[model samples]
Target: MAFEDVVVGEARPYADKVVIEEYDPSWPDRYRALADQLHAVLGDTLRLVAHKGSTSVPGLAAKPIIDLVAAVTDSAAEPSYVPALEAVGYRLRVREPDWYQHRMLRKRIVDGADENAHLHVYTEGCPEIAKNLAFRDWLRAHPEDRDRYAEVKRELAKREWRYVQDYAEAKTEIIEDIIAKARAAGVEVPA
Candidate 1:
């Protein structure tokens, strides 16, 4: 599906340069707090929650936004969880039913801190969950690829992007290459 079709609400153009910040030691704590909140809200529906993306990897420069993955019973069944999430200040931003029933909800200005986070929701057993975890674990164990990804992100951040998603899309090639290497090294990347 097209980007326009997948987004739940407004497809706001970023219209700004991406900002990549040096890794912060406190990122994991922030992720844990958010994960805790998700657990509280999601309860039995939540299957698993994980910290993914660059912020999850220590020493990796990132956009300062925490990226989290929450595996649930059924992501496409929004009525089961979306309302509860919204009640707790999360706004459903993206819903890509065509792509593993993926849903992305975002929380801005987390806990009064000038920070944001994305919660990517997918069904339990989705291969994307394993792929995300594998990517994060690979980067954590391999500094060479981690630094390479950081360099690529820094370079991409230098250019203007119409949408933040565009900036994310730009990193796909490098991400795939790294994941391929991870798979070659016995990492479990579900097909």
Candidate 2:
């Protein structure tokens, strides 16, 4: 999809039906499964891979899907990594140069028959990973904030949009606000 197609609050029918369900403690198992598949595909080129989204946060409601970040030693090494991933059914879909040289791969079953996951790949130590994890961790630690965010998600999910990313972006303001509060409160994720 084109960048223009990612307007906030515009849920693409293609990405509709996505919902944030109550937190599933088993999300970690799902991540582990994907991580194992990824590790077998990329082997040593993978520097670090971690569960870093809402699914990783305990008790924080999330879309019933796993979000993982695979950190490579260098992004220029995509040629070595991307092909292997595709062979295993994960297709590279998004590339962001301005955003920490991030790349995203969407995993689907067969010829786009089913949506499996959204995999975000980046070079080691990218700040975005930390930011994502921190927001999720902070939300998990602060139930009030988590509830507030969940309410925003519920309200947004009720709207129609062209893409789910649009729905995700709509939450950015509140997310950043929470992140700011966390920082102001001196909340930091353990290294």
Candidate 3:
């Protein structure tokens, strides 16, 4: 499927340049709170919820957005869970059925705070879920790679991006390299 076709509503373009901020100490607490809320909202429909991405790593510079991964019984079955999430102020932003039935929802101004978060939802047993968790765990365990990724992010942040997705896409090479290293070390990223 085409990229434009996957968006649920109007695509939000990033303003000029990407912003990478110093690690915030409050991220984990915020994640836990949100996770709790999701569990309450989703109940048995939610298989698992986890903190992923750069923000999950301690001391790593990130875009100041909390990235979360959620596994549901079937992400493509939006009717099963999307409405519940929307009631809690999460807006369905992207729905990529081709990509492991991935669905991304964004919540801005979480808990009356300016912080924003993205919840990447996928079906239970999806390989991407394991890959994301493994990547996050690898980064947390290896500071040298974490610092390297931070440096790359800072450099990328200096460039202008038409969309935040473009900036994220730019980091694919380094991300894949690190993931490769993690796999070679038996990080156990499921295929």
User: What are the clashing pairs of model 1?
Assistant: none
Better of 1 and 3 by TM-score: 1
Candidates sorted by TM-score, best first: 1, 3, 2
- Lowest summed lDDT across 10 adjacent residues in model 2 is found at 3-12
Give one digit per residue, the lDDT tens place, for model 2 in 3-76: 54322233235545657799888788878888998899889989888887778878777887678888898764
Clashes of each: 0, 8, 0
Q: How close is candidate 3 to the true structure, as a TM-score?
A: 0.94
Off by over 4 Å in 2: 1-15, 109-115, 188-191
Candidate 3 per-residue lDDT over residues 1-191, each given as its tens digit: 54568888776677657889999999999899889989999999999999999889999999978899999999999999999998887889898877899999988883553348899999999999999999899999999999999999999999987778888889999999999999899788776
The clash tally of candidate 1 reads: 0
- Local distance difference test, candidate 3: 0.90
Local distance difference test, per candidate? Answer: 0.90, 0.77, 0.90
The deviation in Å at residue 42 for candidate 1 is: 1.2
TM-score of 1: 0.95
